[model samples]
Target: MEANSNIPSSHTLWSPHDTVKDAAESLGIALPDEAAKNLAMDVEYRIHEILETAVKFMRHSKRRLLMTSDINHALEMLNIEPLYGYDNTQQLNFKETLVGAGGQTLYYIDDKEMDLEKLINQPLPTVPRQTTFTAHWLAVEGVQPMIPQNPLPSEIKSIPPFARGATSSTLGNDITSSGLSSDVTMKDRDDQSRNKNTGLSQNASEVKPLVKHVLSKELKLYFDKVVEVLITTDPEKENLKYAALTSLKNDPGLHQLVPYFIQFVAEQITNQLRNIEILTTMLEVISALADNKTLFLDPYVHTLMPCILTLLLAKRIGPASKDNNSSEAEDSLKKQLAVREFAAILLDHIIKVYGSSYSTLKARVTRTLLRALLDYSKPVGTHYGTLLGLKNMGPEVIKLVVIGNLKIWYKQVIEDSNKTDYEINILLNTILDIFRHIKVEVDNAENTSDGAQSISEDVKLKLEERVGTKLAELILEQPDAIAIVRGIFFGEINI
Candidate 1:
């Protein structure tokens, strides 16, 4: 068979026969031309293979520059002995040598040998510093801080001026003085020069805007996977749910996905109100996102608050079972209560975490709950939620909202006989819970005159009357009712 004229016998990447022959001569070996050519091709192929493996090592180390260790590791991986005594910090310099009448060229590494005696006397090199890390704010509120650790604006403008100008203004002003007509006067020349200089200054002042960072495909895939796992209901997928929550809670780059997560939670909560599992999961996702210290959720608090409030104040959450058994009813109620309780906890967390960041957050939450609570037409479940929501805001909120409107709310409840025993019990328990925090101070009547004790008794009666019959009766039933009433009216306890 004949070979094609266009194809070479071996890869051109291989070193020339003369260079291989020179290497063989240095070792006192006389190599044939065919052997030298074969050895050169083999050496080239081996070097290519080693480099391919070395690139893997570089990528694994998260480095761009291929290091000496990477090459050694690649060699080890290939079951070959690594090159020795090659200092990674030092660059190898090669010297060129011309040989024979043919003017053939050969390159050899210029490795200077050192005397053993002088090397042994040299002091040991200084130990390299241990790797350490220091953290600083890379950016705040979407703007990079001009810190010493960050690159300067000039350094960041690394793109060529021509590349930047190509994307900028299209209008070009050629202000060469030679282009001016011969008939132009001195005044015209001066004006043209001044305008040209002004145009140049204007062009110099213009700057190309920084390109906005976009989410990478890998990040988008990760986000979608997280959202899918979070909304999954299978019991076996709990690990996925946990992993998704952990990622949402701890990932630093989730700022871009904050609005998306918020919207997801809102949409799921709206669509899956009857599915307690989904509602709870969505609430959990929101809570996890809120817990992430790196995410700035203050901007989305308004959007998030309504979803949380809906879960807290929804009339129905878990589905009611068709079976009329007491156990099923109890189970349904329990699930509803659990969902509301979780929502209340989330609400409290959001308020504490972001109340100061958003100045109107607390007020806005309080107003929404108050409106629901005071509405006479609202369902009993909503009233229950409103009371619980106020309860979660702490004892001070309970006093301001619950205690202040107790009489009016009591009248409404008393007039409405349609309200169930369960609803009435929840409302009463909520009131008692608020009253429990009100500490009563008793006057030192035993040490004082009888006149002081009579006055204290009168003050207690007035408090009982003001609180109305039902609350007074509930308070009086307690062992320290008189003292409690006296404290409510005359004590230093602030609302």
Candidate 2:
């Protein structure tokens, strides 16, 4: 076996002069001299031959003493990575050979056939990406992994490659010598596949140690790479940015990244960012993040208020050119439409998640959102008209978002629609919700008891009659608004 295991020659790996020809073709230049031609032609083949020799050394050795000591000694003498590339290729092949051996072991013992590709490509659960943004501690070897004792700079650290652990020499040698999981998609499958090679199938419960090991070591590194890709100028990076945002939205543990997303929006808007594609993507991500109450309001609600208001106003104005032609206005319509759709979705999310806490803010936003819807006389601005169908269902849950800021709503709707029936109905519906809130307060304040009638019957009758009559007049004048107004007064509406 030893005699037959001679290293393959350069001639076996590469045809003479092929490398020089390929190099010349790639560079689009001719070799200047014979020495250059000879060096270029044979260099690649020489490296391949040396690696082949190292692979044969491993195959023939009985004790499997495939040592790197000789190569490292050679590297030190050479003062560079050897043109040989033997150590690198040896480390790779030793494992492949071991996996092949392990496949044989399984076949001999259990009479089961192995499909290398399937064994390698199986999917595993990924750690939620949001977890990386949190400043949580990790324990290793009964001690917490400490941050630097000396103060470090504020810049984010580049994650380092995984280092061999304390037990690596003993456990690692056997493991590294045996085989690799054929899957490159999995971060550390070879180490994970060890128990299975020993006849233990890794089920969800059994995979805990592998998960912990990878999460503690590799997850941070992977996330850092993702972040790097997301912020780059490469067009391909958009896919990564989308994935990162989606992961952030789904992750419960990593709430801190939510602010980073808000900051990304702030930065884009401040720069008068032209990448509308990214803006739309950011909007979708924000809408997803807003699904959680803590995510929607914490650290973001205040900043988001101003940003949303500005964007919505810009959208209302259409495009910036003063030409005032129908074509110009028509051309600008797409941006406004996009803004309206995004704003509706975002506002919907906020109302659902923050509920009453966001009521004061909602009132302010409602004026903006409801303007086009309420102003029936003025052709119902495109933004409001498109979203007017929203009004037909019921009042927005956060209708009282502005609470005492009734003037904003009045000015926007009344100024825009002096005689329109739709405008009148919108105002009536909103006023009804306020009245319902007032009634709730009054009822709660005076707990009814037969012995102690809370207030004079006359006073109660007057208040109810006044409120009911005003509501009736509004409803009679605009019957379409009746459902909303009644819904509000009876507290049947979500808001």
Candidate 3:
């Protein structure tokens, strides 16, 4: 006879002897050992056949795992009846039951029957209450109130040395700030320093000291309100910002606020350089303050110069974009250039308005812009802005300072392609435009200066040497380049 290769081996998980024998005996058929073994092998082969079919269903369903429904389908495909009461509706809960005979353990599903009316009659649990809070006095006049909620007198901390006389948090000083003595605040500071050096503990007082300048609470409130409105980035706050700027410009009582505003501008510019909006707003603040006719800003003009100059001469103004090719980078570059231009305009305004008060203001500002203009290390935008500033100062400045140095500066600017052509073109346009205007203005001042003046070959070469060959060519391209160059040869356009 042929070997029955389908017979279950010892590795069979469903042991043929124990399980198959039990199933057979349950049906009153006392299965012999050989018969049990054969039945077990047939059962195992059938199970494998069903599972193989089920795997195909699972794959067609785009699933990695086999489901009960897949097995059901697989049984139908094999022309065999599928088992019931084992599905994925819920997890199978097995109840442990031990038979007393041999202490044999068996697990079975426990589906308890319930009284439907009893379940319906059960009452719901009570609902929870909403939350509430109570308030108490924490402190008064910088001293803790002796309330149950506050610490006892003995538990209170000592006042620090500098804070001895202050009433406002940071703005106040102690008894010294009482307006009784001028030097008391300074001396108290010395005492605090000495205490620190000697490891002495200075008790913090609950008493807040009076602020310096004895500034009214109204001033403090106004300063806070103005700063908040100016610094906000919300589009909805535009009207509020405009109102705040208007108040800064036109308010007569802002005399006391000038120094504070200057200090605020200086600090913010230093700390928030990347925040283009805030930086631009800060410049607007300066413009408003300077525009205020009622206020005297002479003492603080020099103080404000550093902030403006930083903006004017900064290589990059706003936050740098992550990708150079992105629109964000282009926008940032444009905004930064605009900021430099604004700073230039503000600088010119300050010189024109306050220049006479301080005789050297105009001269110093001119020199600064000239230096920045000639500086090849600066970005192209900066040179362009500097040129704008010179033009704003007067027709004479552009003629005297810019007309002579255009070639050398522009040569290096174009050679280094670090800045984009858009920037370079803008600069070139500005220079060309300024040269054209200044020539017309100078020549017009002399007469209808449309007449092109002649120049010698030697003068043209000198012109190339002074300003590079490329610039000489562009200058010659202009209608009045000869007249301008001829004027330069003579004393018509001064350097």
Candidate 4:
């Protein structure tokens, strides 16, 4: 018998290449070529219609139980990305049908681990009875940039004054120094320009001319509702994290809500009573913010630095103390570890962009970041993503921190006999770097000085003893870093 072709090809997922011929062989439905083609098209159309409907439903669905598994799977199949509230517009993409929905319901889905069975078994009517075969067409999606050029939402017209002064030059310099591809360079430039404009409030609004703006009130209302759900007593409700992030996305001016968002993240990382999933989501939010420099200009940008630093430092300090009654005492060390590593990257950007404008912020940020890097020097606490950031900020910045921190460290550790050979070795390398940059800057400063008096013997001797000789040895050993050292020295002198 000729194969019937009403059924979809193969018993598994459908691919574009699957046709009536394969469908007929697999599902035993036979038909003429025209009929088979028409039927196949109909099936494909139906599948898409179902998916569109699913996506729409998931987008605004308030049913938490349904969202965790069934709705999530559907989203995965549909390839719909969840929109960050920071995104000005929400798009409901559909091919054929299922476009008509009752209302645009603001759905919240935390991209965290959850028990699919429990979610399904919940007593909510919206909860799935079984994995709805058709439900696989739905999803809440991930965040994407509204425009190809302006990857960040325009609402963040400028970074906070201090943050802009701190990160712009550093972020740009790092990108350029690292010899990154053109795309990365362009992005850094855009970010820097935006940040530079943002520093002066008068120009902030004009920075992002084509920024996408949505109805801010509607988004705020939805966010408020989501916050209500988050604080409620529902064990199955896990949508708050995404809701908070999305809320910030829609109305970045809702920067006031940043504290609430930070609190939520803190609860996840510190509160033993909270789910690990929440903590993981916090990390995701931070990574997202870091990846998009545009968002770094938001008013909440100031708060983020300390928050990130605390998280990194917490890791080094170890887990919460078992005996502590107050949760603060238990997690203090963890908080420190959390901040230490993360702040390094943020500061690196701050120093590179704002140049001398960020002197005050740079000093504080560098002090914290340098200390963390030195502390974690065995492998350095931060991974490659942020390491390249430190390198871009220049060896001088690193050296400055080293010279500053080394004294403090020596006072605390060496005098107290608290550190080991490993710690001392790390300090040595940092000091070596500092000296190299210092020598370069001094030479450049002297060369540019129009017949200035020669340096006093005493100052020269002090510098030579402190940094020059060691710098020479290290430079001779690794010539590649000499250029970087030279760049920092000359850059500072000229400025």
* C-alpha lDDT score of every prediction, in listed order: 0.72, 0.46, 0.73, 0.46
lDDT of 2: 0.46
Model 3: residue 386 alpha-carbon error in angstroms: 2.5
In model 4, which regions exceed 4 Å deviation? 1-259, 266-283, 290-297, 312-316, 320-340, 350-360, 363-401, 404-416, 420-464, 468-495
TM-score of each: 0.52, 0.33, 0.52, 0.31
Candidate 2, residue 219: the lDDT equals 52
- Candidate 3 lDDT, 6-98, residue by residue in tens: 444545567775698778878988777677777777788889999999999999999997888899999999898987988777777899999
Q: Is candidate 1 or candidate 4 better by TM-score?
A: 1
- Candidate 1 lDDT, 397-458, residue by residue in tens: 76678777877888786456476566577678766755655635444442232323333445
- Ordering by lDDT: 3, 1, 2, 4
* Backbone clash pairs in model 2 (N, Cα, C under 3 Å; residues 3+ apart or in different chains), count: 6
- How far off is model 1, as Cα RMSD? 25.8
